[model samples]
Target: MRKLSLLFSISFFSLYSFSQSGTMQYSGGKSADKAAVLIVPFEPFMYISEIDRQVGLENNLDGKAVKSEFAKALDLYLYQTFNEQFQVLSFYFMEDDVEQDLTYVYRSRKLEYEVLPEESTPKAEEKLKGIQTKLSKTFKKEEDESAYGGQIVTERDEKNKFMNAIISDQKVVDSLNNRYNASLYLLINQLEFRNVYGDFTQMEGNTYDRIAKVHYTLYSRRGTVVSKGLATTPFPASDNNLESITSTYFPILAEQIFNAVNMDITSTKN
Candidate 1:
């Protein structure tokens, strides 16, 4: 009898863990498949020291530039993944927004500027800016077709520029709902990336690694968070390089998140 009880306990926990792999607010069945989701540009957090020490990027400005490049790449990857699952509205400055850039993401009401270097050569500054521009243009060719089904609306009147729609605000939600009439607005507050050094038993060999932890909140038209999901994607030990590993696993991680959060709200309707 004791052995049977132990086996049952193990079986129960295995099922529970699989269900809980993707974070969910309230659970039961899946939500409407047609529900539109506004996916904002992913805000990124990367350890500066890791870039400088491990990646051999010494200049803080250069480190920040690399950080910016990764942010754009992550945004593109996320939009591409989510676009496949839901009708997505985006405020990604690199590919979508008309005027706003990183400055807008600083979000005026919550503005925090990076300190300018105390002393820097003009040549260095110019070089960094050049690299930034080049990297910005690199991802455009990757998209073979437009998922939005129309030419991207790029030309906007100046009066509507500098939209900080990337961050969650009642006004932003209301505006997007007014425009796209999207049912849910997903605000990704942070996509934290950290370097993992050395090998683990899962795969052998000393190598650098990374983990992408996405923290997101989903709001309804009433300005309430209907659901929240967090996805932490770790690189498989076999072949771990930041860019390559992320590209391979991000889709799977995103699918996991969608499965959990896309859960039918009907099950919890009161």
Candidate 2:
């Protein structure tokens, strides 16, 4: 009887560990045929360092330009890498028609800033302008060391809650399933870039490593949550090295994201 009880305890512990791992596969046979995933591009939500230690090509760092380039490159590499295991569905083709206006929530934390949806209207654009001013002011006041700190864990949990609501919308799920027969859904939540050396107070020169965090969610066709986590990678920090960053670290981040979900599925099945 003790031996049997010990076995049962081991089983419970294994399942508990799986739940905490931030990756999961639907144990029930949801899609028996094959893997087909539809990826939503990253929303315009980012947290970046405001320091001038790392100089750009023009000796000025443009945060907007960096965000735009990284968003596009990350999306491309993600699709390419995941296509190896699944029939990747491109949502970029119909982006404008399906796109919703976004409202920005600025936070001085790593991956805590949010770009949530609002109705498409002139007011939305006006509101965004105000938010941009606020973000700029906040960034201007922050140093690299303390800018992305002072975050409570609940902040991220709340953002994930909001993300869950978006991904679990039945109407959207139904539309995608009907239109593309997509069995899996991937949503890029947010991204952040930070310099490796935290203390900018004693900086000698310009060179440093830049680390990126790509937060994402994966769900089943029925809007059942599969996995949600962040994939991170570091590259040589250079403001003018967008080409190198795209060609190198983007692929690494993509592969990390893919393996995060794929390995979970494999482990759960076995």
Candidate 3:
């Protein structure tokens, strides 16, 4: 009985260790003479705000569930990219793991109408009466004596538009450096999602597509930006899974970071 218990414990520990070992190596790169290149794993801090609800999905899913999927996807991407040349050091930071005084801006704008009407003369009282009725229905009518008999239009636009929070602080940078022991850091500056309209003359069934655009920057220990990159990818409107859409661009981003690091290391040596 004692021997069986010991064997089971050893087996469980071995499996646990194997599961935890997340490293990848890339072939073809010059043999590493020194292990100076340390890659702090990519931390997904941008996904935190949506913790309570599902992102881009009709069904609501908690942040904890989404994180596991993200980890699996990220691990797969890193393994494919590095495959024998580089090693993934550790899963250092996650969105929920650290405290951040960060703010984000999400701007959305829609042109209400075409600016083609050029009428020099104001259409007088008759048309104005009908316009007033329509405006009243659409907007919360306010009485302001300044405008032609105290009428004012205050309402949300037919085309919804808004600019979200803006996050910027020196503390964020300092905290990142202190926690990771990394001299360089990466920041995801912009992530935009839009529906693009197009002419169907080219042969598509639908006249519009949903696209995602990402902009990011790399900063050195001195807070100097070393490099920046942008990527745009399209996703089918039917598949409104935000996680899936975002994961599509991860490889491109990982590659960009790898190339940037390679260049920096080479430049320093020279």
Against the true structure, what is each candidate's TM-score?
Answer: 0.49, 0.58, 0.41
What overall lDDT, based on C-alpha atoms, would model 2 receive against the true structure?
A: 0.50
TM-score of model 1 (CA atoms): 0.49
| Residue pairs in collision within model 1 | 29-264, 30-263, 30-264, 31-263, 31-264
How displaced is residue 169 in candidate 2, in Å? 3.6
Give the clashing pairs for model 3.
25-82, 25-83, 25-84, 25-85, 26-83, 26-84, 26-85, 103-167, 104-165, 144-150
Assess candidate 3 and give its lDDT: 0.37
List per-prediction Cα lDDT, in the order shown.
Answer: 0.42, 0.50, 0.37
Candidate 1 vs 3: which has more TM-score = 1
Number of clashes in model 1? 5
How accurate locally is residue 152 in candidate 1, as Cα lDDT from 0 to 100? Answer: 18
Q: Estimate candidate 1's alpha-carbon lDDT, on a 0 to 1 scale.
A: 0.42
- Top-TM-score candidate index: 2
How many steric overlaps are in each model, in order?
5, 0, 10
Model 1 agreement with the true structure over 1-270: per-residue lDDT tens digits: 333234433433432221111211111223225556765544433121122223212222233443444454555455555555555545543323322433343352231212223331122223323322111121121122122111112221211111112234666556556554667766665554433433343225534344444555566776766655455555433343334544576665566556556663444464
Task: List residue ranges in candidate 2 displaced over 4 A.
Answer: 1-34, 46-63, 93-95, 100-168, 198-202
Decreasing TM-score order of the candidates: 2, 1, 3
Encode model 2's per-residue lDDT on 99-160: one tens digit a residue.
Answer: 33111111211233344343211231333233221111122323333322211122112121
